[model samples]
Target: MNDNLYEIFHNVYEYKDKDTNNHFLLTENLAPGNKVYDEKLIRIQNREFRTWNPFKSKLAAAIKCNLKHFAFCENSIVLYLGAATGTTASHISDICRRGMVYCVEFSSYAMQSLVSVCEKRTNMIPILADARKVEEYLAIGKVDIIYQDVAQPDQIRILKINSQAFLKSGGIAYLCLKARSVDVRKSNSRIFKEATQELEKDFEILEKIDISRYEKDHMFYVLRYG
Candidate 1:
């Protein structure tokens, strides 16, 4: 394995030549000899590469689907809504090693798993609260990014509310729009267009990605706070 082939994205790494996948999110083995979500780990010169499974992570699938902008940076402070079990949150924490991720998950069961993930990752803070109620997390200050993946009919509303309360001016947000969740009866295209239009008032759509390859009926909307 040629380590030179691995491309760097903050703390993440993507191998240029790989049989299994095109892009991978690699992090320093925070827990030596341990794996999160049964992902593939490759160690080279004191660095470990975890296969960021797109099928398991909508953000990863969006990246694979040509997501043009990555808002997470070294100085980024993130508000992550619906961080179910911290699969993608773990990777976000990895990328924002110098920053932090406030992971909000409503389900008690999911929070249990997320808490476990937070135990190992110092950068991730697990909050067992509803995304709709941003005031619940008073400890969390303004954040550079807001990422939402809630599978609710009012998903766009949830994101808009959180973004308004938490997102800093000029901040970025990624909303994982589940078409079926919004309206099963309507066409996916119509739902996507309507949702995008709703968000235009508060956000500037940066990139729109179709992630059907890994997650069906899912669209990723990258937006910038206006």
Candidate 2:
């Protein structure tokens, strides 16, 4: 892994390691090869980099499952909802090196940690506000992407509201659907069906990937706003 052998896979660099079949995100290693929220770093090309653990991030899990779309890119403006402590948000920031990540989190306690992560990356912004209230961040204007990982029953509704306010037309969105959060008793497939039905009204469902291996009872949705 230290040979610096790297390949770009949908805006993320993958390490050529014959030891394991796991996929990883190539980060600039903002921190030393230490654990940031339980994520590890691997050195490649003589550059210290962090390994994007799939179990810790749905976006990483989707890539592990062969997701085709590369939604985020350099200089891409992104609106991230439910950015708890900036775990996945950090990886996104790594991919969008020249871009900005507007992280919206309601918990003040979590925002504190997120701010620490932002200090290391100039492009990352930490906002303490509820995702349901889009007006709070209306000044951010339109963004290229909207990523929502909120664990609420009305996650789809919340995403729709934020997309309408901040996301530009033709923008991409990655939503982590936690079936258990929506309904504890309903079948996972049935919950997904119901959510898709609601989301189809505003955005086109690009791809629905099962990420249960990393996050139990979860599905990752790739959407394109019309």
Q: Provide the overall lDDT of each model, using Cα atoms, as 2-decimal numbers.
A: 0.84, 0.85
TM-score of each: 0.93, 0.91
lDDT string, candidate 1, 100-187, tens digits: 9999999999999889889887788999998878789967989999999999999988988887788889999999999999999999
Please, what are the lDDT tens digits per residue for candidate 2 over residues 1-226?
4543565653477766668755456666545544458766766556777778887888988988889887787789999999999999988887788889999999999989998898888788999999999988898889999999999998999999998898889999999999999999999999999999998999999999999998999999999998
Prediction 2 TM-score vs. true = 0.91
User: Lowest lDDT 10-mer window, candidate 1?
Assistant: 1-10
